[model samples]
Target: MSATAAISVRGLEKSYKGSRQARSPVLKGVDFEVARGSIFALLGSNGAGKTTAVRILSTLLKPDAGTALVEGASVVEEAQRVREAISLTGQFAAVDEILTGRENLVLVAKLRHLPSPGDIADGLLERFDLVEAGGRKVATYSGGMRRRLDIAMSLIGSPSVIFLDEPTTGLDPEARLEVWKVVKELTEQGTTVLLTTQYLEEAEQLADRIAILHGGTIIANGTLAELKALLPPAKVEYVEKQPSLEEIFLSLTGSTKQGDHS
Candidate 1:
């Protein structure tokens, strides 16, 4: 375990027992580290074990083999400490539609046994730009507002690390941008974020460091500039051939799906 890393993993492996004891392996010796206060993205398509990795780091699931540490605490050995040091927002907004947005924040604060839950809720509501909607039921809020509330709830205990598993999965373009802004603001406030996403642009726009997860293992890991350097210089012919954003993304992730390169 590295003392300075906010999150670290080494030779991690996991397998699930499916249908009559049939084994399905997800992660195979996966390893990566997230720096404190930085946005580290695990970029992979669906079924690439992004969620599985987040689960293990957040102490919600155990790894069958290998070691992972969160905030310098062993996720396996210090599960309770890890749990206390982190917050997780799943693919969907986990807000209670029946409750008012302010109520949801206050509920989480109370569950955490914090003093002055109402004050905490009010501060969060203002910080997340939800003060106007705080009194309304969450069901009436827009997708972006609900997502903002979901993230604000995660900040209740001021955890050292946050695991966002595809935080913008079903959001529209405008909503996605809103979430992106929030993510950036979290890092600015010294909160380390481990974001898992299949959206190439999401990683490109937000992550200070990007790790390409393919087949449950990291195939490429570096700063954006370093990863971009993996490609050769663009060819200049009679007419220069420029690759599309999709082409660059697929190529970087070690994918073999490029239709009609010609």
Candidate 2:
């Protein structure tokens, strides 16, 4: 493991027991490293073990094989230390609809046994741009707002690393962009992030480096330019760029990111 790497994985493997006696393999000797304060994307389709890798690294699930280190602590051997150094925000928004946004943030801070939970909640609410909505029930938040609050909640303990599993899934283009901006801001604050997504544009727009998981192993790993270099350079050709359907729709309907736009 590199000294500057916030996460390091080598020869990772995992499998699950299926019906009767059959075993289904997911990860097969996977390996990668994420530098501290950088965004590393894990790209793969459904059932490609992207989430499985995150689960193991976050110490939510034990790996069947291989070594995973989070902030220099072994995930399996020093699970508690790993947990203390990391936070996870899964695909779905795990907010309590029954509580207001402020209440939700305070809840997580308290759960982490942090000092001045109320102050912590206030800071996060302001940081996430949820000040006005902070007093409102989470049930009323838009997909973007809910997702933002979920991420803010994850920062309650000030974890050094954050695992965002398919963070922008199911969001509208505008909402997705909103989350993208937030992700960019996270890295700017020196937080290491491991993002998993099936969205190609998401990875292209955010990751400092990308690794593609296919058939239970890493098939590609490199920067955007490096990965693009793998393919033959395009022959020179001139073509006019046209606005995409998303641009046209957003231009025509002028749908706001608030309310039911999600």
Candidate 3:
């Protein structure tokens, strides 16, 4: 493992046993390194083994072959230590629906045995922009607010790395942007984030490094500019620009809102 790497993997392979003679291979000889305090995105379509890779790295599953290390600790041999150093948020929001946002955070903080759990919860609620909704039940919060609270709960332990698996899957465009801002804030605070998403724009917007996983392997890995360079140069064409559907919707809505306010 490199000294500068927060996470490292080499020759990682995993397969699931199916019927007597059948086996389903997910990850095949996967290798990658994540630099400390940077966002690394694993971009892939459904069934591309992105979630499998995350599960293995987060110590929820063991690799059939090869090695993975989290902050110099072996994920296989030192899973407990690895778990202590990382937090994972899955595809769906994990906050308790019956609990208020503040209660949800306080629950996690207490579980982590942090001193002054209430103070930690209050701080995170403020940091995640949930202060206004802190006393509202999670069921009453918007999808974006619940997602933000989920991430804030994960931070109670102050882990060095966080794994987000398709976090914005069901969110609207505005909600997606809200999650993006949270991700940016995390990286700015020196947290290493590994997020898996099928959205090309999501990776382009947030990832410092991107790995494109295809057919159970990494087909390309580099900065966005470097990956773009691998493609043929674009041929310039002269054409009239037209507004997209999203732009049209926003424009129409803006006009309606202004008229109502007037």
List TM-scores for all candidates, in order: 0.93, 0.90, 0.90
How would you order the candidates by TM-score, starting with the best?
1, 2, 3
Q: Write the per-residue lDDT of candidate 1 for residues 151-218, one digit (tens) a residue.
A: 99999999989999999988999999999999999999999999998887888899999998777788
Residue 150 local lDDT, model 2: 95
For model 1, give the 10-residue run with minimal summed lDDT.
253-262
TM-score of 1: 0.93
Scored against the true structure, residue 116 in model 1 reaches a CA lDDT of 98
lDDT of 2 by residue, 60-157 (tens): 89999999999999999999999999999998999999999999999988887888999999999999999999999999999999999999999888
Clashes, model 2:
0
The local distance difference test score of model 3 is 0.86
| Residue range 1-262, candidate 3, lDDT tens digits | 6989999989899999988867899899998999999999997767778999999999999999999999999999999999999999999999899999999999998888889989999999889998999999999988898899999998888999999999998999999999999999999999999999877778888999988776677877888767766555545579634433222222423333212100
Error of 1 at 240 (Å): 8.7
Candidate with best lDDT: 1
* Candidate 3 deviant stretches above 4 angstroms: 238-262
How many pairs in model 1 have backbone atoms within 3 A of each other, for residues 3 or more apart or on separate chains, i.e. clashes?
A: 0
Worst 10 residues of 2 by lDDT: 253-262
TM-score of 3: 0.90
Per-structure clash totals for the candidates? 0, 0, 0
